[model samples]
Target chain A: MKTYLLKWWQTIRISWSKYTAYRLNFFLQVVGPFLVFFFIKYNLWSSIYGEDTGQLIRGYNFDEMMQYHVWTLVISLLGQGYAAMNLSEDIRLGRISSYLIYPFEFWEFHTAGFLSFQILQIFVSSVTLGLAIFFGFLDLPSTMTLLHGFSFTFFMGFFWFTMQYFTGLLAFWLEETWIMRVLLSIVVSFLSGYIFPLELYPEWLVSGLKFTPFPYMSYFPAKIFMGVETNFMMGYAVLAFWMAVFAFVNHLIWKKGMRLYTAAGM
Target chain B: MSNKVIEVTNLTKQFKSYKKKPGIKGSIQSFFNREYTTKKAVHDFNLEINKGEIIGLLGPNGAGKTTLMKMFTGIIVPSAGELTINGHRPWERKKDFKKKIALVMGQKSQLWWDIPAMDSFLLLQKFYELSDQEFKTRLDYMAELLGVVDLLHVHVRKLSLGERMKMELMASLLHNPDVIFLDEPTIGLDLVAQENIREFVLDFHKKNGTTIIITSHYMADVQALCKRLVLIFDGTKAYDGPLEKFEKILGNEKTVSFSFSEEIGGCDFIDKYDAKWNECRNHVDIRVPEEELREVSKKILDLYPVIEFNTEKMPIERVMKTLMTNPEVLRQQRENLSS
Candidate 1:
């Protein structure tokens, strides 16, 4: 157990240093694109609500609607873009062979590396939030709301990471997974409420989506920060269930994938 | 470890792959009716590698040298037959089994590319659960031996290929594995760099008595490190014995060259010897059996005042070329091995 933790710690340190080696590239890849994306969403939301100060569409005043989008940006930065691409690339190129001979498992190494990247992004996300507050474009949530929302979003991050890993495991059979990545991006954006809020959808659709893991990804945590009505217990339960399901599926895929890898020299 | 560290019997690996037809219609047809072929990468291979021996795996491309190495290192599973390294089944991939061996492939890097080599070494230390003192001692010793102590702090991508390869060796050796597998370790290196790597490997082997299996296209690597050779062809073992035996088994033709002080007054000697003349009229080369070397030299000297004359075995490249292209000789050798 001590050795496991030590290896993971070293993985984090080494991976973080690797990611930060190109400081400019890190900012451009992580910060620049997301900032542009957020602005585009901001403009689209503004156009929808119009210039009126009293606009309240779907129980969200203009300020609250913009805040929802801001939180989506935060959640996207904190919880999305898992290590699927790198994982799939390694599998496809047979580079994973080099690591298979090592004492540690492949998934553990990648998970620790992904966690390291996300941990650094947490600091980046905080700075973005601080800048938003300073610009008078955002309001801080209450202490109780902050605690609940953070814990929810943190767990959701891991849930999303597992889902991404599940997608990456398809590379053992598929030569290229860019199509799957594209499909995943579209599904995540539409279902996770990154494109719009669950309230904007039909009542049946909203009820159905609540049963899925999507709302817990962007809507639940962002709502807590918006001081909107929320079912924290229900959110936690759904996220945990889906996380367990994904984890089980990821493990199955990993077992079968390793067999195929060893058999065929992938 | 016992003397017999590695044993294999009728080990085989066959890869199943589909052939893609060209064009859009063919692509659709392939999706519907893909034709799969099973190419045997390693076929009925058998060997026994003793401890503390350097064996060269020699073969043409696609002859399953790398496949066999991968099987030995536990990176790939054999489709059939039994294989044991240090009495452990390779496909089990036990952590203890892995701790006893290390593999280095010239085409692939195990080091983190963007980070300093030292950082990767530290991660490996943790992976192997090496104590801080043990890790530092091995790392320092290997780094100094390879003359790479200063390059360890530089990013791997920024270092030259030779420097990076040295670091790779250091990383693999830090835990002092009992077995090492090197696949094309000297590929794409200059003469000096290749010699340096070869010398380091020799020194390391002499000191530690580790069992090593290396595959290289460079004969110099084979000549410098390995006394025994295992030659495979067409996915099967063709010959396994001392390196010198390869010359006797494959072919026995020796080249005898003669350089004269002045051009021969007459060209009649060429007809008697069937010699090929160099562009300069003074030099001639004749191929003869090893037993006729003295007779051929005496005859040549009777005709001309030889400034210099020499007899040497055929170059390894020529032998390999003949072996790779001719199926008849390879089949005969395989039959010999079986018998």
Candidate 2:
């Protein structure tokens, strides 16, 4: 166990060095996208509730709407920020051959990389949250509510990781996987209420989406941060079940992909 | 215990690829209905390597040398057959099996490009479970031997190709693997760098008694290091034997070239030996049987003003060239010997 832990620790350390190798690229690639995205959402919401601070759209005043979007931004950075871009490229270019030869398993190395990225994301998200509070876009919630929101969001990160890994593993058959990732992002943005509050959607659509894991990913967690949703059990159970399902499916896909792996272009 | 370190039987690997025609029309048509073809990259290949042997795997491009290397290292699974290395099935990819082997490809860099090589070595130390002392001792030894100790802390992307290759060798050998597979380890490098790599490999092999399989297009590497050669032709073993025997595969004839002081007409005696003359007829190369080499050379010296005479420097090179151009020569020789 000691040796195994050492392996993970060393890999994480190496990953940190790699991530921070280029200071400018790291700054631009990580925080730049989130800032631009939040800026656009902030403008779009302001225009929709133009010149009227008292307007309420689906039980959300303009201030409430801005607060909700701020939480979504925070949730995005903390929960669904990790992408498997390098994973598919590694498989496509035959770089995974080295990992296969190493004593460390490929998934273990990548999981350690994810852990390292999550650590950095935590720092970035906190800074963003502080800036939001300073700008008066958000008020400090109770400590218990803050703790509960963070705990649930972190759990959602694993489910997002599993799904991204599934798409990344499709490199065995598809020459380019970025299109699939884009399609998945668009669908998730619409169904998980990242674009608008689920309360504004049709009743039938919201009820149907409850059967899926989409609501628990962004909507439920953001509501928790707003202190408007208290039913944490349902979100936890739904996310856990989907995580298990995706994990098992990823295991089977990896097995099938290994059989088809040619280690091309080495 | 058996002395053999690697054994294989009836190993085969087939690769399937779809064909697409040229232009947009062809692409659209193929998108609807594709034609797939399967080619055998390695077929019914069998080999047994003993401990402490450095064997050269020789073949032309696309002749299955890399495929065989991949199979031996478990980078890719074989379509069929059985293979074992160090008492472990490589494709199973057990932790113990991975710990006992290393593979280095000349066309690929396994070291993380963004970080210093020392960081990668540290990561590998943990993966291989090397003790702190063991790791330090091995790192120092290899660094001093390869003269790359100063570059250990520099990022790998900043290093030259030759320097990166040395670091690659150091990375793969840190664990003292029992078996090492080198796939074109000196593909593109200067003469001095190539010689340095070959010398380091020999020194490492001598000290550790590690079994090594190397595939290289440079005949010099084969002549300098390997005692035996395995030739692959179109997914089959064409020749497998000692280096000297492979050198004389075409025939047991010696090629001796003589340059005369002046442009002299060819003598009748030289014509009997099937001599090839230069434009001026002052220089000629003759092929003589092994038994008659001395007699023929003496006769030529007595007849003409021989300014300089020398035997072939690299016989294996000429043999490889001949076999590559006309593989039928080797086939005919085998048939004649069997008969």
TM-score of each: 0.94, 0.96
**Model 1 chain B: ten consecutive residues of lowest lDDT:** B312-321
**For candidate 2, lDDT tens digit of each residue in A49-142?**
9999798899999999988888887888888865467788889999999999999998898888888877878888887888788878889899
Clashing pairs in 2: none
In the range B60-148, model 1's lDDT, one tens digit per residue, is 88899988988998888899999999999988889999889999887778888998999999999999999999998888778888888
Can you list each candidate's DockQ?
Answer: 0.68, 0.88
Candidate 1: what lDDT? 0.84
TM-score of chain A of each: 0.93, 0.96
Model 2 spans with C-alpha error above 4 angstroms: B280-282, B294-309
